[model samples]
Target: MGLIDRFQALFRPKDRENEPATVAMPPPRPSSVLARFNVEQGRRATVEEARRMYDEDPRVRGIIQTLARDAVKNGFELVVEGPRAEEAQDVAQAMLERVDFWSRIDDWVRLTLRDGDSFLEVAANRQGDIVEISRKPTLEMYVRTDEFGRFVDPMRAYYWADRLASVSERPPDHAIYFAEWQIVQASWDRDEGSRYGQPLFASARKAYKRMTEGELDIAIRRKTRAGMKYVHSLEDASEADIEAYKQRNQAALNDPFAAVADFFSNKRTTIQAIQGDARLSEIEDVLHHIRTFWMASPVPMSLLGYGQDLNRDVLDEQEKQYRRTLEQVAQWVTGQFVRPLLIRQWLLRGIWPDGLTWSVEWASKEVSTVAVLAEVAKAVVALRATGIVSDETLLRMLSHVMPDFDVKAELARLREGRPDEIWRMAQLAGGQDGAA
Candidate 1:
């Protein structure tokens, strides 16, 4: 048995089991508007002053004008549907036209709902009617039109208003259907940047298929709209379809290989995102440490600029080479995640059944005549065992990760003799990313 095998046989954990690691959840969004209406509906104080401000502010005159035009042009169509349907569609169109009107409404809603009743109780009471109307495509189309019309345009607003109103009035479970349509209407009126917009869009889109086929009821159909908005505002996961994503990502956080893959794969880009999030304070410290060690050091050329070039006077050629090697080693070792893995036997060499086993101890080192010969032997063995070895790959992967070593000739020889080491390096480079 090899030395590593013998050691493993004697000391390996017998059970070979690992406890499940808890996946960390991202922080929740700061606000939720649908949730407010769901719980506090009638109990919350009306923001009458803010509502008045919207109507009176000249900055919003453009929106009021556009909404009034749309409403008047299609007044016969809107009022023919129902009072709530007519009011909701007009309000949505008007609010969408005003600059920053959605932001103002969001702030007002948040303030009003601060001490109101819970949204769950309200949702529970409205569930039955919501399910009833969800099956109708006509109603579903109206919901989408009125919702999207506020921000985009209202070309088909009349048809949608009529469809929604008709569905709401149809069943024994009328209240639930009406409440659900209102929820969707409110969600449509929300600002684009508001937490709920995307998911609501997704929900509305998915429900469209069922509604088209006449399978879903008005109530269940409307849930897709509200649920989607709730999902969008909270997690931003709705950009991808929910059903497909839930199936794919359900065990993503639990799979170790997948976790490690995602970590390194997203290392360069996600590090910046983590730094930007207000929740991740540690990212700043990590960035500071990396910058100090890796890129901020004084250049050797700068020392010579001040005429401090202690040229050949201080050391012989061999001694100068040693200093260069030491500097290379220092540069390679700083701020690396796998420093411990490469530190102990970086310069060691061994003969084994698998060929000559050399430790990846130092990334940068001064070469002696004997050390050079050992490096050549190590390269030959690595090539023979792995079927590939290259100087550039070794320098980037193993040599750089352990400690710096200046082995230019060895690197060149390995490049010509062994090339498969590149693949091995890629496999080994799963999660030891040190970049901040």
Candidate 2:
């Protein structure tokens, strides 16, 4: 097929006439014996509620945003490795600059982290240039899969004042799907063949709620006076008098700007301040819950701005693990999002490099100190001087320390006998030979 034809085929909606028209209904609950309950409806409701909470809940927003930002904070660059690597890299760079690929991916990451799954619809003009890319919420889209659990079609429902007005099938190939985790069932017939993804915070909802409550309790404690027990003699005071006295005391205590005044009373009321040990314990419990949340999430405590007392080695290991996860996400994004868009862009422009294979390289999560970089550079230079490795190898080693360093450009300069300033400085230093 030609480029347009292939693109069309990839996105063509299935014929509605060929298939039985079935109204979309919630899948039956697995717990139901007769399959009367629509558990899928409940799940959809839950996902919707979770989405709402993610938007409204400050703690949820903070946690998810932190994860999303950190995942792509290092950012990513497209790397093409093959005979036409340089040409492909140039194309990738152009595509990035034109489209703001990193920013788009950052947005996608945030959505996926918030919703557990994110869908992007790619629209191209007749010239094959991507005109727009938009995100579709999972709540608005319903995916259908074949008997074998493969995606068949996705339907988008439009709502008018929260009532479904029309349902339209999205062109299959026009959408890119990113799911962090999928819920698969053994009996595909019993469930929606398309996988359902739950957000990372879904399981920790209760813990988060408890932590929030604990924080609120602490705040209330900080603002309010400690509880006091009043011992009043019933012999002299009527119930009405006792009630009035209690109300006055509460009003005085609750008023933020009220000043305390000692009053002499014949009732002989002895007041003692409530101990704050319980409030402190509750605060500790909140911390425990937070730690539990960190354990459940892919993010480490250090990444979320905790773990200040952690040793450097431990923090490094945690960051390494987190970066590894981001790297995997980068790989998945490259395949699911970048590749197809780039291919479409290339076909539109009629520019296809031979043996083109592209991958993504994330910037280093750990910033190397100058001392560390200098020491590593010294070792690499020594190795190069001993003829143990070539200049290309040295450049590759330095690329780890300085990701922006263009190894290919440096190699080309060396081959053409046009050394850069660094090379000239090295030569000059060597010529000095401690003469000064």
lDDT for position 264 in model 1: 20
**Residue-by-residue lDDT tens digits, candidate 1, 1-436:** 7433332232222423542354553332234323333322221122222233334533223323322222112111111123344333343333233323223323222222221111111111111111111112212222222121222112111122221232222223222322221222222123544312211112222233333333233334444432211121223334444445445545743463552323222112222211122332234443333233222112222222322445655435534554564444232222111121111111111101122222223232323354454454455445434647444544544443223334454455566876455334433343222211
Candidate 2 stretches greater than 4 Å from native: 1-6, 9-43, 81-87, 151-196, 213-260, 266-280, 283-285, 308-316, 343-354, 386-397, 403-416, 423-436
Report per-prediction Cα RMSD to one decimal.
36.8, 8.2
Per-model lDDT? 0.29, 0.55
Candidate 1 TM-score versus the reference: 0.14
Query: What's the C-alpha lDDT at position 129 in model 2?
Result: 58
User: Largest lDDT belongs to which candidate?
Assistant: 2
C-alpha RMSD of candidate 1: 36.8
